[model samples]
Target: MIIEISAGAGSPSEQIRDRVTGLITTGALARGERLPSVRQLAADLQVAPGTVAKAYRSLEADGLVVSRPGSGTRVSDQASSVSPALARAARRLASTGREDGRDLEDVIRVLRAVW
Candidate 1:
């Protein structure tokens, strides 16, 4: 569960948001998988608690994650079905990266360039 914040990425909260979205999209964080508490993520990511809270709140608003009263946050069951295009794109990016020795980031850039 290591999330590395890139120096060239966006703001901390947005970066966290993107990373969490990637986790759900790639199935790394499965439906109903428990996420770290906001305090815990803040400590681990060295970001403010508010930053983590903002990211979690955004995910909740988008229905990608759910907060349980005492059970912590869990990846939403809906995330698995959120976007057909995203799922397909994720799979394609993974396959392209594996077969051609391209990175997923590179694949994304190429896809964007072509389309």
Candidate 2:
């Protein structure tokens, strides 16, 4: 929920989207957790409200979050449940790779190649 927007990054909306997605996928934002209001987040990030709205819309479309009138936005309970599980699996994989003596860069390279 602590998003730092870099001026040198891509479009503001894209940066917002990427950060939110990363948080969800890494299990930092739990399912059903409410996100800051679009206006509030935009003000905090110094971007237009529309930018945050666009990012929220994108996350909604991707099944990563949900927004309801009066309730604001929250992580999607169903889809988000899968993200933490996937993150846990990834962490286990990384741990096993390290135990097997694989360097971080090599593990990253393998992951990228496979991906």
Candidate 3:
């Protein structure tokens, strides 16, 4: 799972929080998926370790990432699911991005693929 912390997009913490949350919400990162260490992710994104740690702390508080002693942080089971609106919006973007540009067929295709 890639966690990007864009400095200009939002408060560093909020950007980190949103990116991680979005991944979980979109199912790009599955339940129990291990996350990079704070030091590692911080170096990768060029953000301060405190920023990544803050985001990880926020995620843990939200019941999204669980940290175990000696083991890495993992995605919580709660992240395996998302709210209906977000799920729908993600499908809409993917379905609409096709060459047909979001016709009923696209919707049906998404429905079939999902359902």
Candidate 4:
């Protein structure tokens, strides 16, 4: 799973939590799939281990993931995925925006305005 941390966005922990949540809900991370260990993801993201741990704790609190001593973290079975139709529409929007020479910020701004 790829998680990007934007300096101008929320805190590193929040960004991690939100990104992982999005991945789970969009079916990018399957149910019962193991997430990177706290240390591993922290090293990958260049954040502290505590940051990834905090995000994992938040996800656990939200019932979106489960963490065990030996198993690491996995998406919870109850973590519902977004409908395929909605996922398709999102991909379509992203593709169309890129094809139209629009940057991510531009597409996000339009999405925000529409929302």
Model 4: runs farther than 4 Å from truth? 90-115
Residue pairs in clash, model 3: none
Give a tens-digit lDDT track for model 4, residues 1-115. 8999999878999999989998988899999999999999999999999999999999999999999999799999899899989988988998999999998799999999999
Task: Give a tens-digit lDDT track for model 2, residues 73-92.
Answer: 99998754345678787788
TM-score of each: 0.71, 0.72, 0.69, 0.78
By lDDT, the best candidate is 4
Evaluation by TM-score, superior candidate among 2 and 4: 4
lDDT of each: 0.86, 0.89, 0.81, 0.94
- Candidate 3, residues 57-99: lDDT per residue as tens digits? 9999999999887898899977676777878876666666665
lDDT winner between 1 and 3, please give it.
1
- How high a TM-score does candidate 3 get? 0.69
Global Cα lDDT for candidate 4: 0.94
Q: Give per-residue lDDT, candidate 2, residue 108.
A: 87
Candidates 1 and 4: which is better by TM-score? 4
Model 2 CA deviation exceeding 4 Å by range? 81-112
